[model samples]
Target: MTDAPWSHDLPWPDDLPPFDPFDPAIQADPYRHYAWLRAHAPVVRAGRADARLYLVSRYDDVLAGLKDATAFVSTPPGGAIIPGLLLMLDPPLHGPMRQTISRAFSPRAVNAIEDAVRTLVATHWDRFLASGGGDAAAGFATPLTMGVIATVLGITIDDAARMRDWTNSAVDFIATRIRGVVNPDASVDSYAAMRAFMADAMDRAAADRAAGRGRDTVIDALAALRDEDALTADEADGFACLLFMAGHETTTLLSVNCLDQLARDPAALWWLRAGGSPAAFVDEMLRHRPSVHRVTRYAARATTIAGCAVPAGAPVRFLIASANRDAARFPDPDRFDPDRRGAPHAGFGFGMHICMGSWLARLELRLMLAHIAATTATIAANGRRVPVEGGAFATSGLTRLDLSVTRRSA
Candidate 1:
């Protein structure tokens, strides 16, 4: 791919070190590369010609691009537009759709489920602590997050496990698409299965509501909208699928990240255990080790990001991880300081497209951290820390984190 207006052959700063976003090594720990790019080439071209990508790394540039929805659109021109999938929508369509969806999946809905979520957290953590700890990601965080989102969506526990499996496939499919190497064969079947399941669930929700037995779950809410002609059936089903897919996985990673942090830093653990705010810790963790690191947008028209020119229709990869760590935005950017104040990190993104489920994710993290701090005396890593297979291009966190914890004395 051409390196923008810099030259036809070489990357910006001709002697720049080799950088490939898809490389497993780079993805395993991308901060070093992010730091290098932030310092030297905040905006540069990457990938091959057919699937060229423009990388934007600085905090200000990324924020600007995310806010200027017109300049950097969610979907490329002529790309397949999935109805009800808010992530791919922009402007006029996005605003009304989001507003409508928000009515059903509102903060009140999330808040109402707190007691149940807390109970769910306790059940999982109690078991984990009783076992003296195990794979925190799979044993605790994954199931816990899946359960919470499932409850919110009104999915039965029996189906929650299936949803978890389907979510994994969906996430893999999405990651492959972002890398310009979609594998329909590997993920399409599971994706279809999930859509069908959600459709059935929505149908059930609608039926229950008509019979005056509506449970007021997210499904019920969306179904009511559909019945009232407020949302198309396709939109309702698409939104339900998006909710499960987006809600479960990202929050799981964030939970695991908190566990990983507590295990690694005694001071952080002590602060939490000693009654320091889990809210503060969570905010810093989102910045220091965000579960999601990069987001893609298509350059709608010719534009310049961080002084680098981008051509119309070019694919732009905003290095959210890099932007969060930019010293320009955060003092001593490399260090993980829970007490961090001032500019908010791009962990949950920015502008209109900021994560819709961010409030829910934060609540999950804060509760999980607070519980761990209150019950555990010491938390330590018991084995290797495995990074998520896809790298940081989409979601990034531990796939397997073996933790050992000791309970506080009675």
Candidate 2:
């Protein structure tokens, strides 16, 4: 991780337990450390000196930070904000851009794609069941999610694979940039390639519209809006890229996590199989094992979070995963109880910057889990599950999860 130009000047409580965000052990399973942080140090400094982080683990504190955009802004002062990237913008710019983009990507738009998503999930599940299951992440979740997002973007199957690769690199680039780290493995070429692809897609959509052939895709919608001067060319392209990158990977991880959790708890699987609510089950899964663990925000002004003083321009890491599991907010937070209800989880985030594609993600997850429960009589771990490397900062889920399943006898 590259050292931040800003120094770690926060008062570090001496009795707080040592915590490192990059530590492989903590990354693998951070619940224990999160618990400690919430109990002893709801807000504290962690990470290396150069890339120091003001970590917030308590649910209330994190929620408040996410809500108060004035105090905790998306981008730091004087920081280079990516044009058209909705997540990186704030206030005056963010609201209008978000409103404009919402026209293209909304709940209604997502609902329109439900049948296609269902078909994709059914097809993938069929193939997996026929083969008695394999690596659920690769054989099922990954391709299934890629197909759904590709459909949403109106991209060809041939382009989906390449887009996935580009999305990975782009995500790595973003994560490293947030951490002040220089990722040697990630490439700027990927960003160029993705942007080029989006531009081409928008152009194609525009051409098709000119020819009186509307595809009714998100790209098509954005293209029309662009023609109306509602969005700039850069904004259109950036929205497409963001949707492609954010849509697939996070959903894929959530699907795999659901499956993993099901394999461990037969009762949960049975409950799902017995016509229990997939939406509720998926909701619990999100809280129990969210795909993305943390999000970094810059302190827009000097403030006190959870009673800890934070300097302006400081990088504050809101541990979403930790917040979801906060005992003070959710009784028996550690337990994975689908029926459990209380405060909403921070799995999809909260406040102004909550995930825009959250509804689509939930739809995909619910349908996939419902299909699995309906079709599969048994689910069991077949081998070791491999975690995504260096996913602690960006996203975290199994890269490979071997599972064996038995189809229900019809």
Candidate 3:
């Protein structure tokens, strides 16, 4: 990939040293770290307490790296960080697995389920509104997203809460090189619980597929794969795991973030409803308060970024929040101005491997925001909700969202 104009602004450190990821000071306000890294260290060595890795904070470098699959592979071939899961595999092999999953996951297919998703959202909305409202995150977003995932996967709505537990266990934690200096065992237990649950779910689905009792599910379609495009057992499991994780988790976050932003800013909300252009608010929400805050890339080969040469076998962290808020690419990057006349930001991502679900995510957020605005009389900050720690990955968002509302007078 060609180097971008913005790459010129990124400067590498001459005296490189690994910054500690586990530092409480860094965790408290990572933006300070992001500023230091993006301006002075495009590629900086960083220690995550016990874990060692390199941090890549700038937008341009991270974009280049994600596009350069040859130099920054997603996963090794036939790789299963856990057995029977192919979502973790790299390209040549990952291509086929992705194709198989795409049959079910792509925007076209997901679009077909829009009515279902909207209905699910309304079902939760009615209940949440009737309950005099509670934790918006737990009461509404969780069930709404959880039902979408379950329904799409050909599961019963009764399994809504079960799927919620599985999704939370699998994703609601940290994932960066850095973390709080707390229980080593808790992390292990959380991961173990998630994997075990998913494994059981996969096993049950697999058996149902063989017995011809799986009903018509994406899992059944995947299980019944024939010709040259079929997945191995582990690949199926891995794909299922990744699908559930991605489908519900990020969708939930983006919806909450969009609604929260709209409630706080009436002009932005008005912009969304007028001219049939909620996409602007959606773009701003993604740029301003992107759900997935950080992502990782391991070096596939030696490469130079922003004039710094990196050896093969190094890991790089991409601070996405910083990238969206980058002044080089976005004017007044920090301010939440949806009407700012500029190019759409890389809130979803740029280059190859860009989020396939970007459109759907935008649609979901728009609909949910529209629903909340139309249904609720008023939305304001009352109490507060803590953000979940992103664990080893700094993408965790909104463990709680305290929202107060009154019915919109019809």
Q: Which whole-number lDDT from 0 to 100 does residue 70 have in model 1? A: 94
Q: What TM-score against the true fold does each predicted structure earn?
A: 0.93, 0.93, 0.79
Candidate 1 steric clashes: 0
Cα deviation at 355, candidate 3, in Å, is 3.1
Candidate 3 shows a clash count of 15
lDDT string, candidate 3, 173-283, tens digits: 322112223444334454455445545655676687677776545555555552233666555655666666677778787777765775676666555546535667677
Residues 1-410 of candidate 1 have per-residue lDDT tens digits of: 33453213434344444677777666767787788778877887777767678888899999989999999998876566676789888898999999998989665676778877898899999899999999998899988998898889999887878877787777666545544554655576676788789889989988887788888589889888888999998898888888888898788888998888888888898988777899999999999999898888999998887767788988898989899999988999988888889898999999899998897888888888888888889889999789876633687888899999899998
**Model 1, residue 337: displacement in angstroms?**
1.5
RMSD of 1: 2.9
Q: Higher-lDDT candidate among 2 and 3?
A: 2
lDDT of 1 at 15: 49
Residue pairs in clash, model 2 = none
- Candidate 1: clashing pairs of residues: none
State candidate 3's TM-score: 0.79
Candidate 3, residue 51: the lDDT equals 48
Error of 1 at 21 (Å): 0.7
Ranking by TM-score: 1, 2, 3
